[model samples]
Target: MENLPKKVRSKKLSTRVDLTAMVSVSFLLIIFFMVTIELAKPKAIDFNLPDNEWTYRGTHISCGPDVTRIVTILLDDNNKIITYSGLLFTPIVDPKVLNYGKNGIRQELFDRRKNITEYSTAIGKPKNGPIVIIKPSKKSNFKNLVDILDEMAIANIDTYAIVSDFTPEESKLLALK
Candidate 1:
């Protein structure tokens, strides 16, 4: 007490938390995501995958004029996938070709795989052919529209896009100018 300073010293409080644990967890999450995400380069049918880094944000990037091999899907007035390669695969009225598989042999996803394996040779590969391009018309039902997507996925049709026309929209904007 005899050696104490003339000015009184105030007590100090500091609540410091170490952030090393949080930084470790963040790094672990980043590594997990990097490992789990598919690293395969974008494989394509007709369109060249854009080199632009800003536009690759969706499951299906839209098709523009640069696209070539496209499987254009048109819906007749009845809204079915009426024409594929100029053939009437889906029909109107009688029998309703689209749902023909509904009442037939019911196969789950597993069953479908087993059958696909058994008939793998019979089912030709699409890799050797013209690149696939999908064109869906307006007014098509969401169900049928998605059905096309499902089939494409099942068929492993990886490289395709839903066709879009830039000319019309661009023309309209040009006219305004």
Candidate 2:
């Protein structure tokens, strides 16, 4: 047998994998998702339904002197907004005709709210704003109600009610208009 010279081959190529670019791409995607994602904010109006007692005891719920702070808004036909302040039993401020817009009912509501807050502070009482009573007549459209509700929210009024009953004075006022 003849002796053969053995040739030494280079070590097998290393299979090292570079994961830096993959990691960077993963981080970028995560950042993009974090930046672009928006959380949903729910918009809603809170309403209180009349209880059984209220039904039995008549619709006019007495709110004391706060009644003076109560603002009654009547949604009339042809997008007319009539507003007054005070209780049904007592003499109320004369209903004023108003329009629908930023300068109209919205401004009045804002001013009334501000006045109530200032008056409360001046009288050394806790700031309790007026309670708005919204009465939508059968003649009023649905959009009028929605717009008034939106105005209530925009005015930052925390207390208000939607009463269906129309008192005699309200009826007379409507008739006169």
Best-performing candidate as measured by TM-score: 2
Please give the CA lDDT of all the candidate structures: 0.40, 0.78
Q: Can you write out model 2's per-residue Cα lDDT over 1-177, one digit (the tens) per residue?
A: 367777788899879989999999999999888766743445576754222221112344543345556789999999998888766555346678899989999998998888777866765655567778899999999999999999988999888888899989898887787
Q: Write the per-residue lDDT of candidate 1 for residues 3-76, one digit (tens) a residue.
A: 87789778776678889999999999998888767464465455444221111222334443211122334432
Candidate 1 stretches with Cα past 4 Å from truth are 1-70, 76-79, 86-127, 165-177
Residue 142 CA displacement from its true place in model 1, Å: 2.5
**Candidate 1 lDDT score at position 115:** 41
- Candidate 1 TM-score, C-alpha based: 0.34
